[model samples]
Target chain A: MKLLEDRIKKDGQVLPGDVLKVDNFLNHQVDPDLMFAMGEEFARLFQDEKITKVLTVESSGIAPAILTGLQLHVPVVFARKHKSLTLVNDLYTSTVYSYTKKVSNEISISKRFLDADDRVLIIDDFLANGQAVMGLIDICEQAQAKIEGVGIVIEKTFQRGHELIAEHGIRLESLAKIAALEDGKVVFEKQNN
Target chain B: MKLLEDRIKKDGQVLPGDVLKVDNFLNHQVDPDLMFAMGEEFARLFQDEKITKVLTVESSGIAPAILTGLQLHVPVVFARKHKSLTLVNDLYTSTVYSYTKKVSNEISISKRFLDADDRVLIIDDFLANGQAVMGLIDICEQAQAKIEGVGIVIEKTFQRGHELIAEHGIRLESLAKIAALEDGKVVFEKQNN
Candidate 1:
């Protein structure tokens, strides 16, 4: 976690609209060693949960989620934002609004992947408005899957994401918690949970 | 590679439009164990390449790419299909046509990710017309990166994907090569490359 926090402060860029760009090492251009460390930390934290599946959204979340799945020795089921050619029907679907993209997308997971027997741990690159994680949770609920908390690489503490996830009574863990991104600097929250 | 082929034969579905749906284990619902197996196989195949980076497109390719990066002790950079909020304009961009999606999408990588110093090995979930891989190669070309080779999970041999990639003089390795999908059964080519 310290490694992630330090790397974020050193390389993260702040844009208008509260955008903290960690693309240099995080989402777009992934550092696999760093990603493995993050995943190991997440797996260590949630080792007792007996996580059956690691769930995430498409695109950005795939890297960390895959590593986590590898660490946890579980299958990963990424909710597709669009109707992929191979994805079948009878899916657990949820609509999520993307704060960055400014467009709502339908996130769906196959019914065959997640079911009542699944204990799902949701993982993602960043948690800001909590919309994406919430959508994943909604799909799990629809499938009667047990929730096994959420793991995030970076958390924007200034946003309402943490509070929203807290309301669901799900345990949330973020590697790096950013207090703010001001003056092109990343401020970390003193206490990370 | 045999593990991948075995799994594909058992779980992969043959859909219309030359679609081979291995979503059960390959793309949507990823088997990390199997994915790691594929990565190890890829690492074994390209061991002498001294790959500096493993590259792929987002959404599905991250799983294998991450595992391959882990095995190779390298970084993984995924080209974004959409312009993400944090991605900058100093990018190597290329347009790709998706035969399955019936839409054209622009794939891009930040110039910071790929460079002439990198020996990139492009990995993907499927290979059909090779447009996606070619687009990635184009982006790498723009970056002046040295391409090590291309690794694919499944290749529809009935399509021209192999021919197009061969024209680039880049080595191609596909885990499973499908000869045809007739009568709702999947047929694989006699030889794999």
Candidate 2:
């Protein structure tokens, strides 16, 4: 977690409208070595939980999800944004409003992948207003799967995402939580440990 | 490679209209152990090349790309399908036509991630008509980066993807090359190893 916070401090760009650009190492361009380290951290945090599947949204979350799955030796299921031709008719669908893209899109996972017997861990790159994470939680709820925990790479603590997940009584762990971004500087939340 | 080929044979579904769906392990739901094996195989295949980065399209390709990056100890840059507020203005963009979706979309990589000095290895889930690969190739061309090779999980030998990539004079390595998927059965091409 310290390594991730350091990386974000060194390379992250803070822009207007609460935008933190980590393309150099997190989202668009990924640092695999650091990603694997983060995966190990997630595995350590959720070692007690019975996580059967790692669920995430497409594009940004896939890297961290893959790394976490590798560390846990579990399977990862990414919800596709666009409906492909091969997607089965039976699916758990949820609508997510993207504040970045300014569009509402439907996210879905095939019913064959999730069921009541599964314990799921949801992972994502950024947790802003918690819309995307809520959508993933919605899908899991529909499938009757047990929510083990949620792992995030970078979280905006000033936003309502952390509170929303906590309101559901789910354990949420984030590597780097940004308290504020003032004058192109990232202010991280002080670690209690 | 044998493991990958075996997975394809067992879990891969050959639908009507030349569509082979391996979502069970490759795309929608990813098996991290198998993904790690494929990454090791890719590292072996491109051992001679000095790969500075791993490039791929988003959604389906990010898992393998991240695993391959871990093996190579390099950064993985995934081209995003849509532009978001976090993305910078400077980018390398290419248009790709999806045969399955029956539409064309733009894939773009941030200019900050790729440079002329970087040697990239492109990774993907499947290579059918080579449209997505071609799009990545175009981005590499625009950035003036060196493309060491293209690593594909499954290559449909009956399709023209291999021929197109071959024509480009880039080294193409596919773990499993299917000669045909006729009558819902996968026929693999014998490797020349």
Candidate 3:
């Protein structure tokens, strides 16, 4: 977590609209060694949770989630943002609104992947407004799967995302917690895990 | 390679219109250990290429690409399929046509991530018609980067993808080469590496 927080401080660009551009290392261009370290941290945090599956959204989350899954020896299931020809019906579906993109996408997972017997740890690249996490939680609830916990690479504490997950009584662990972005600089939340 | 071929034969389902659905292990529900093995295999195949970077498209390709990057100790850059608020200009762009989805996607890589000094190894989940690989190659060419080779998790030899890459004079390595899908079954191409 310290490594992540340090890397974020060094390379993260604070853009307008409270957006922290970590595309240099986290999203668009991924540092696999750093991702492996984060995955190890997540695995260490949730090692005793009996997690059967690791859930995440497509694209950005897949790198961290798959790495975590490798460390945990579990299958990683990524919820698809686009409805492809291969992914048809018999899915656990939920709608997620992206405030940045200003669009809502129907995220889905195959019904065959998650079920009542499964315990899933949801992982994602960032947690801001919590819409994406909530959508994943919605799908988990529909599948009757137990929510073990949620692991995030970066989180904005100033946003309502932390509060929303807290309201659900879910155990949330974010590697780097951002308090605010002021004058093109990142402010980290004190006493972060 | 044998492990992946065995996995495909065991869990891969052949659907109508030549769609081999390996979502259980490859795309939707990913087996991380298997992915790590594939990454090791890929690293062995291209060990001497002096690859400074691993490139792929987002979503499905991220899993294998990240694993490969982890093993090679190189940075992995995934081209963004969607134009987000944070990803502005200064990009190398190309269009990829997905025959399965029947759509064309504008994929872009940040100019900062790739350059002429970098030697890139392109990785993808599937190489069907080679459109996605071709798109990545185009972006690499635009950046004046030297392409080491292309690595694919599964290659449908019956399609034009293999031929396309061959015509480009680029080295191509596929974990599992599917010769054909006959009577709802997958047939492997003879004499596969």
lDDT of 3 by residue, B1-193 (tens): 7899999999999999999999999999999999999999999999999999999998899999999999999999999885333445798888888899688888999999999999999999999999999999999999999999999999999899988888989999999999999999999988722
Error of 2 at B82 (Å): 3.4
Runs of candidate 3 with Cα error greater than 4 angstroms are A83-88, B83-88
* Model 2 accuracy (lDDT, Cα): 0.90
Worst 10 residues of 1 chain B by lDDT: B82-91
TM-score of chain A of 1: 0.95
Q: Who is ahead in lDDT, 1 or 2?
A: 2
- When 1 and 3 are scored with TM-score, the better candidate is 3
Tens-digit lDDT track of model 2 for A77-189: 99988533345478888888988878888899999999999999999999989999999999999999999999999999999999999999998999898899888788899
True contacts kept of each: 0.90, 0.96, 0.97
For model 3 the TM-score comes to 0.96
- Highest lDDT scorer: 3
- How does model 1 score by TM-score? 0.94
Better of 2 and 3 by DockQ: 3
The sequence of per-residue lDDT tens digits that candidate 3 reaches over residues A1-193 is 7799889889999888888999989999999999999999999999999999999999899999999999999999999995334455798888888899798888999999999999999999999999999999999999999999999999998889889888989999999888889999988889822
Return the TM-score for each candidate structure.
0.94, 0.96, 0.96
**Model 3 chain B: lowest-lDDT 10 consecutive positions:** B80-89
